[model samples]
Target chain A: MAIAALAGFVGALTGLGGGIIITPALTLLFGVDIRYAIGATLVGVIATSSGAAAAYVREGYTNIRIGLFLEIATTLGAIEGAILATAVPTSALAVIFGTVLLYSAWQTARPGPVSAAAAAPDPLAARLRMNSTYPTPEGPRAYQVQGVGYGFGLMAGAGAISGLLGIGSGAFKVLAMDRAMKLPFKVSTTTSNFMIGVTAAASAGVYLNRGYIDPGLAMPVMLGVLAGSSLGARLLAAARTKVLRALFGLVLVFIAIQMIYSGLKGAL
Target chain B: MSRDGGARRWTDERIEKLVGNLLRAGVLISAAVVLVSGICYLWHAGTGAAEYHFFHGEPSPLNSVSGILASLRTLDCRASIQFGILLLMATPVARVAAAALGFYLQGDRTYVVVSLAVLAILALSLSGYWVR
Candidate 1:
């Protein structure tokens, strides 16, 4: 429970989810089965997303319309991924998971420069009215969204990975919105946070019925992650983003290497 | 168009506040349920050994909603935990349902349709109609 709390804290602070940390920790440190770990992590992802999304939404950092629209793609993809997870070999799943973690580490380590705002409003975005203004230290900064098709495609992939691994897949969501759609980082992260819970919920039921969700393990994890994320949400406004990103990147790289090694050795 | 923008912004703020509170309440209530069950689990089975290296499917008694409730009636700690996790899972579905309603109330026909699609997907998964 304590470890889950710590993972939730970091996850909330970094715009990731507790599952990213909790999955490996459960499998490697606690010697838990990969399937059970995935199930438990899915529950923790829901808890953290719910607890943190509240604050982000009220702060106006989240775009609910964007989140809702993208969810259609994600929910469909998540169900497919969850079903496939049952059929995939554990070693292969572990290797895929490790590769994703490495990608996450790379994503975090090399932050991209802010893209130039589009002069021409995207037809799809304009039609959908996917534009918003976010409050900054200066004032409400207005921004226009672009590349809706690309963003939706990316979200589908994010959802598939999330379902297969029982994670939030926030890194992919952020990339989709921030890079493909030109949403601000704050908007990307908070909206991703808002979307993640729904994505996880779509698959959690399947896991539950499949008998992967162990109550004894899930109880402490859910409560701990919820508590930790609630606190993390409160502190996010005061956090140093660059420092957190750098440190979190290092952690992800380390974990990724270990996971890959374990998977290859058939130890996980 | 500017006037329409102003009105949209106003509605957006209101919806954001409402949704925020809803998410917060869901987490709190579910977490509280989990906390109670967690304490019970630790108290009763804290010292027990649990193996995690291999897959052990959950017992039939804890697999479904009906089964979980039945176990809870017997004061089973594991059932309580499952119940709490169910509530947690419900939180996001509730958020999606609320968003659909909010769009309908705002007369956003397109978004209402979009939100409903998302909700339908979630509903299908939860019902075990499609995922199974």
Candidate 2:
């Protein structure tokens, strides 16, 4: 129980790959069932989303409009993903999901700069008026969103993966918003925070209907994650971004390797 | 980069006002619901009719008729319908809130309408009638 809380605390501080971390720890270290671990992880996802979103909303960091708009695609895609997961064979899905997680980890480890050129405002971005600014040491600077359509499409895909794999798509969503849409890093992160809950909620309902939710497992995870995420939110302002990002990247790589190993072992 | 642009600088004073309004509204609505629900629960508990269980399967004292009645009255299926309605309403509310917050934070309204539209869709989807 203490371990779960500590893991959740660290996970929340780092944008929640904690469940991914904890699942292995629980199964390998504590000998809990994988099924139970996954169930608890889902609850943790919800708790983290809710806890982080409320603070982000209060702080005015989240782009609620964009987040809400994109949620339509994500929510629908999540339902479809949940449905597909049940229909497919477990082993086949495990191999595919494991590969995707590895690819995602690799991509996250080497994030790129937001834009190459201070080019003219993208026509689509200008038309949609999808440009905004934020506080900086230099002063408030405007950023224009590019490739919103592409970003939304990617979010839908990521949402489906989230539902199918029981992993929060924060990293994927952040990637899409940051890389494809050209949103500022802070805005992308906060907007992703706002939308993840809705995406998780969509699939969570389907999972509940399918009897995937076990109350006993969910209770402890949810409570622990809720507490942890709240604490993490408090620390966001004080924490150093460079150090956090490095730690986050390392954690993702480790989890991806673990997932690959587990998948191969299960197949064998 | 222009002379006109120099005139338009981000001001914390404007942002604070917008955030204050949103906080006030959110608090007002959330408090109302909590208060009403609390009253209903207390009334049921006093009457020995309302009943509920805690996480560990312990029977709560308010599991009698009054308890059930209060729950049904205060938070019945109709409440879900109402929540769906509120969610729909909240999209625009969220948009306004976002716009207000964004304006306060950045002196811009880039996502106000976009946020409201999303809320509207969420409300429609969650309405239950649509799902049925």
Candidate 3:
């Protein structure tokens, strides 16, 4: 319970999926069943989303319109992914999901341009009025949105990954909103928070139908993550970004190596 | 320099207006749906055939409604349908509450619409129209 809480706290801070940390810890460290671990992770995802999204919305950083529009794609994709999960082999899913997580971790570690290039406004963004400014330490700043279609497409992919792997995929969603749509980091982060719950909920329904959700496992994880993430969000503003990023990178590398080793051993 | 300043100020006004329009439309629709759904559920509580199993751990068919209104009854269902309902309710409540807060903090009308949209989705989902 303490380890799960700690993992949730770190996950909330870094916008990483608590499952990426918790599932392995539970199964590898605690010797819990993998099915139970997945179920617990789903609950953690819900808890993190509910807690963080509420605060993000209150802070006025979440682009609710964009989040809602993208959810259509994500929700549908999530259902499909859940369906696939039951049909696919567990080992295959684990290896693919781990590879994807590692790639996402690598992408997050590399710095990217914060602002969009000067060019013709994307037609989809222009239609939706997705371009907007956000509050910063300086003042309200302007940002241009681009690639709405592409961003939504990425969200669909991310949603599928989340459903199949029982992971959050906020990193990928953030990348879409931040890089492709050129939203401010705060907006992207908050929007990711808002979208994650709905994405998870969509698959959660399917998981429930398939009997993947175990209430005993889910209860402890949900309660732990909700408590831990609430504390983490309170601490987010005061924490140093560089230090957090370094810690996040280190955790990702460790998890990735562990996953690779586990996959190879299983294969062998 | 003064002309550039004037142009910038004018653009800001236009931008604000556009955002305001979107927000107003979004919030009004979303909130109405949520409020109505919540009211309907409460209204139907008296005579509806819906079962109210508090601590149901697993899903099963219930012919008659069983209302467990107290906190102690929460553990009757295996997965807790009541808890699921509460969880479902949280999304809209949070959305509306957040939008209201956003309005107070940023004075942005868009927040209001965002709140409503969140509620609308919840209401629609709860309606069971899309469940199948």
True contacts kept of each: 0.89, 0.06, 0.03
Kindly report the docking quality category of candidate 1: medium
Per-residue alpha-carbon lDDT of candidate 2 for residues A137-233, written as tens digits (9 for 90 to 100):
6676777777878988998997887677666767778778877887766677667765766666566555544444443345445556656766777
Please provide, for model 1 over A85-117, each residue's C-alpha lDDT reduced to its tens digit, 9 standing for 90 to 100. Answer: 878766776787788879877876887665447
Worst 10 residues of 1 chain B by lDDT: B1-10
Q: What digit string (tens of lDDT, one per residue) describes model 2 on residues B1-132?
A: 543352255343344335435533543453344334444444544656321121222122112222323444655432322222222223223434454445434534444455444445434333322223
Which predicted model would earn the best lDDT?
1
When candidate 1 is compared with the true two-chain complex, its DockQ is 0.79
lDDT of 3 by residue, B3-89 (tens): 555446544334334333433333234334323443444454455533211223333221101221243164344325334433532
Candidates in descending lDDT order? 1, 3, 2
Q: For each of the candidates, give the backbone clash count.
A: 0, 13, 17
Q: What DockQ score does model 2 reach against the true complex?
A: 0.09
Off by over 4 Å in 3: A114-120, A240-248, B1-132
Q: Is candidate 1 or candidate 3 better by lDDT?
A: 1
Residues A58-127 of candidate 3 have per-residue lDDT tens digits of: 4456676687668767766766676676577766666765676587668757775643556556887766
DockQ of predictions, in order shown? 0.79, 0.09, 0.07
Candidate structures ordered by DockQ, highest first: 1, 2, 3
Q: Sort candidate 2 into its docking category.
A: incorrect
DockQ-better candidate, 1 vs 2:
1
lDDT, each prediction:
0.83, 0.56, 0.60
Preferred candidate (lDDT higher): 1 or 2: 1
